[model samples]
Target: MTKVRNVGGKITETTKGNDNSFAKENITYNSQKKISFTSDKGIKHGKPETLPPPELPSKCKVEFRPSKSWQGEFGFDWCRIGDSQLPVDKPYSDIVGKYGAIYATSPSAVFTIKPELYQRHLAEYEKFVLSAFGTYYVPNLSLMKGEIAVLDAAIEIKENPDSMYYKYDKTVFEVKILEKLSNTKGKHFNDKVLEIKCLKEFSSKQKIELIATKNKIDNKIGQINVLPNNKVKEIDILFIPVEHNGSSGTIKGKEITILTNALKQAYVKGNIVRHKEKIKVGGWWYDLFFTKKDDKGVVSMETSNIRSIHRALDDVFFKEKDNEIYKNHYRVYMLTNSTSLNGMAEDIGKNAKVVVVYNNRNDSTAPHELMHAMGLYHTFDNDGLFTYKFQNTDNIMDYTHQVGKDRFSTNTWQWKILN
Candidate 1:
C-alpha cells in the first residue's frame, strides 16, 4: 500500500511492504521535464518523470507565486501548498514568462509545462532578471576556485644575457626543490606547483636594462585610466576575522600585513596590473586596500554554524556585492584553513566577485583566486583528466611553475568584459 501526505510543501510518500513494514520517501517534482525523489538517508531513489504528476494542473496563465516561506533569491516556489498558489486557475498565456515559466514548487522541486518551452523561456527570463538586478553579464568565460601547490623549486641561472637570473645574485643560480604543499589527502602532485623557474640569464648591463623596464611598468601603472583602458583605482577588501565560540580565528595582524603586501607584489608580478590595467590595494596606493582591527585579532561573533563559512559570510557582511565602494573593488571571506579547498568562487563569470582564502602563506593564491573571481580561466586546466590542449603552466592561471605569472599573454580578451 502507498500513502501520500504533505508536510510543509514537501510531499512525503510511504509504502507498506508485505510484512507490514513502512518506508518513507521524499519526492521532488519538476512540472516541466521530470520528477526526482530521495529517501531519508540522503539517497536518490528514482529517475525524473517525463510527464507532469496527476496532482498538478496541466496549464495556467497566472504565475505561481510562492508563500513567504518559499520565495527566494532566484524565484517563486511551486512545491508548497498555500494561498500563494491561489489565482492558480487563469489563462495559459498571462504569466511573466508568457507561454512557459518553470518554477520551484518545493525547495527541491520545479514545475513547467514542457521542457522545450521552459528552456526557450528561461533564456529570455535570465536576461530580464540580470537586467533588472543590474548585474554585469560576463559572457562565455567563467572560473571556479581551485587549489595550487607552492613547492620549493629552483632553476639554474647560467652566466649570459640570454635568460632570467636569480633575484638575489646573477652569479649563483641553483635549481633545487625543497618544501612541498598539498591540497588533498595522501595524494600529492608537483605538476601544478607554482614556483619561479629561471630560463635565460641576464648580464650586468641587461640587469640594469631590466630595472629600467620595471620602472617603466610602474610608470604605466600610475598613468593608467579607469576601466576599458585596463586600469582601475583600487580593489577594496574587507578582511574580517570570523570567530565562533571560544575558538579564535587563525589569521593574525602580521599575517594580514604579509598577505596584503604579497598581493601588491603579485599584482605587479602577475602583470594583470601592468598589461591589462592598474590594480592596487584598497587604500594602500598599491593594488588593494583592506579593513583592519585595532587589536590585530579576528572579530569573534556567535552564530549558527549550520552552513559554516557561507552562513557566516552572509551574517557578517550583509551580502556580497560588486563594486562595494568603487569600480573593481570586492570583498573576501577568510577562514582558518582547509586541506581540500584553498579557495572557492562561482562557476559563472564574475557574478559576486567574492572570494574566500585560508590562512596560508602562499602569496600566489591571492592573485590566482582573485583572478578566478575576476572571470579569468586557468591557462591549462585538466591536462591529463581530459584531452590535453594546453600543457603549459608558466602563466599565473596555469597550475605549473609560477615563472610567467608576472607577464600576461597577448590575447586575453575575456578580461575586457569585466572592464
Candidate 2:
C-alpha cells in the first residue's frame, strides 16, 4: 500500500517499509541553502523560485562624464547593474572602469542603450539568447502586436528633447530610432517634378521684324482643346527665298570691270574672293526665291544669311501671286566681291540684299557668305560659338582679314541653325 502526504503544498507518496521513503522523510534542507531539485515528474528546476532577468547579456550601459583635461574627452560610471553594465568576461565593476578610461581618451562616443530603454532592449536580448541557443519558438503574439504602439511612444519621447538626459555632456551621445526619422515623410508630385524653359534666338540681320506675329497666328486658330492623340494640322508657307536671279547674266561692262578688280584685290590680300575676275565694279547681288507651295516653305526660307555675308535674297518663288509657280523649294545666293553690291540689303529693300566684307581676308569668308545664303549666322554673334581661346583673327562677324584659314572652327549651334 502507498501512503500520500502533502509537503510544501505539493502531493508526494511513499510505499510502506521502503528504504527510499525513509531517506526522503529524513532528508532535511535549510531554507537559505541553494540546492538543485528534481520532481517525481523528472523535471529539474533552479533553486530560486524566480530570478531577476539578465542584467547584461552582451551589451551594457554606463553614465558618461566628460574629462576636464580635454574639451571632447569623456569617462563612464556604472549607475545600476541590470540597468547599466552588462555581464561580460570581466566583472561589471572591472568592465566599467576599463570603459571609463577608454572613453576619457577618445573623442565624442555614443552610449548605446539608456536606462529607460532597457525594457525593450531586454526583450530583444532574450530573443538573441534564444536564437544563440538554437531554440525555435514562436514569440508571444502580443509582443508583435504591440510593436507599432511601442514605436509611437518612443517617437513621442524622442521628439521631446528634454526627455533625454546628459544635456551638457558633449562627448557622450545617444541616438534613438524615432529621433533619426522624425521629419521624414512622403514627397508631393509638385516637389518631384520641376519645370524650366530656356530659349534664345539669333540672326545676322539686326532687329528681325515679323510679317505675321506668333500671337496673331495663335489667335487666328482660336482656343481649341487639344486632345492627347490629336495633332495640329500642317499648313502651307509663303514668302521664303528658295532661288535667286542674280547668280547668272552679264552685267554692264563697267560693272563687270569693277567686280573683276574687287576679286583681284581680295585674292592678293589672301581674303576669300568669290569671283575669278581681275577687276570688279558696282555691287554684287544674288536673289533667293523659295518654291515650296505650302506654309512650311516660308519657315525654311527664313533661316538663310545667319552669318555676316554680302548678297541679295528675294523670296519670289513663295511670294508669287500664282501658287503654281511656287514649287522650287530651295535656292542659294552667294556674292564674294567686297565692292560688288556691298551692303546691298541696306540700300534697296526691294531688288538686292548684299553682304559686303569691308577690309578682311580669310578663306572663311567665301564659306561664310554661302552660309549666309543658307540662312546661317556667324559663330560668335549668338553667344553660341566656343573657341579654345580668342585669337587675333577676323571676327567671324567682323570683316577683318585672317592670316590663315586654320583659324576657323564650327560648333553645334552653327550646324543647327544651318540645318
Best by lDDT: 1
Candidate 2 residues 297-341, lDDT tens each? 431122244333322333222243553442431222232323222
Candidate 1: tens digits of C-alpha lDDT, residues 251-333: 33333333333233222112221111111212221111112223757432222221244433543455334324332345455
Task: Give the Å shift of residue 236 in candidate 2.
Answer: 19
Index of the highest-TM-score prediction: 1
Clashes of each: 26, 50
Residue 220 lDDT in candidate 2: 11
Worst 10 residues of 1 by lDDT: 218-227
Overall local distance difference test of candidate 1: 0.30
lDDT of every predicted structure (CA atoms): 0.30, 0.24
